[model samples]
Target: MKISEIKEILKGRMLCGEDRMDAVIVAGGAADLMEDVLAAAAKGCVLLTGVTTDHVIRTSKIVGVETIVIVRGKNPPKEFIEMAKSFEIPLMVTEYSLFVACGRLYMNGIRGLDGSW
Candidate 1:
């Protein structure tokens, strides 16, 4: 699915990388832990998380994440958004909790890295 579609699905607000909203995402993964993202996320997937840190943006870059969806309506720090913009990674936030965000994406046909949810 596309990042734009994800935004619509989750009622999300784009924080950065507006140009990247058209980017197509291959999969989705939800994790607050950076280690889980490194180990489980696929290249070009969307990452759903509650954690909003510069570390999250860094990990997303390393993992080739196409988008970062901050759950539970949390707003990340300005520096975090700046770092994401510098890395060319798209970032968004949703009012939905992590679980709901993940489920909505899954229900909309975005799957896990292995193509299973």
Candidate 2:
């Protein structure tokens, strides 16, 4: 799925990297634990999480996440946004919970990194 379509599905607002809206997301993953995120091998995936720390942004970059969606209406700090921008990773926020956001994306045909059915 395209980042634009994920934004529409999650009703999220772009926090940065709007130019990357065309990026392709082959999968989705939701997690607050940075270790689990890294272990998920979420390359080219859209990550959904409630954690809005700079660490999250940094981890996403290292893991090659295509986008980061902050759930439950939480807004990432300016530093986090700036870091994501520098990495060319799109950041978005949604009013839904993490579970809901993941479910919506899954229902829309996005799969898990582990290829779960």
The list of candidate 1 runs beyond 4 A from truth reads 115-117
- In candidate 2, which residue ranges exceed 4 Å CA deviation? none
Candidate 2 residue lDDT tens string, 15-80: 997998899998888899999898995689989999988889889999999999999998778888
- Local error of candidate 1 at 44, Å? 0.4
Per-candidate TM-scores read 0.96, 0.96
lDDT of 1 at 37: 91
> What RMSD, rounded to one decimal, does every model reach?
1.1, 1.0
Q: Across residues 4-116, which tens digit of lDDT does each residue of candidate 1 receive? A: 89999999999998998789998899899999999899889999999988889999999899999999999899998999999999999999998888888889899887657
Candidate 2 C-alpha error for residue 9, in Å: 0.4
RMSD of 2: 1.0
* Pairs of residues clashing in candidate 1: none
